[model samples]
Target: MRTIHAPRLLLLLGTSLVVRFGQTLRSEDRERGDVPGWVMITLMSATLVAFILVMAQGALESMFNAAMEKVNP
Candidate 1:
């Protein structure tokens, strides 16, 4: 429906613009600041979040494959 699609399109456009602006600001800030602690915390958090997501994805894929094999065979 138009109503559902219009909001989703607007949300996607808004998020893209915000992400671009934030990327520019982050690059500028990295050059201007020597906040080692803040950078380390951000990097550590990102690493942990990525690790969790990857593990979750692998587990889900395994479970789905097992289910599919059982169902098909």
Candidate 2:
């Protein structure tokens, strides 16, 4: 009997599940909203932060330092 390693077994199982899920989604082909919205929210938030950092970097840094000082001291 051939033995499969643990990592290899997990990879195989993950791939099988992904393929099965893809097949199920294809068969349904309607109301596809199986998305983790956090992804988009995170991207949007990062973009907003970048804009804020560019616009008010000094103000933001000062605010952060003040907050940290209050927390620490």
TM-scores for every candidate against the unseen true structure: 0.34, 0.39
How much lDDT does each candidate structure score? Answer: 0.60, 0.61
Off by over 4 Å in 2: 28-73
Q: Worst ten-residue run, lDDT, model 1?
A: 1-10
lDDT of 1 by residue, 1-73 (tens): 4555544554555455556546656674666565654554565555555545555877889989999999995
Instruction: Give the per-residue Cα lDDT of candidate 2 at 39.
Output: 44
Alpha-carbon runs more than 4 Å astray in model 1: 1-34, 58-73
The numbered model that scores best in lDDT is 2
Best by TM-score: 2
- Give the lowest summed-lDDT range of ten residues in model 2: 35-44
Clashing pairs in model 2, backbone N/Cα/C closer than 3 A: none
lDDT of 2 by residue, 1-73 (tens): 9998654554565555556655656765556565534444454455555555566878889999999999995
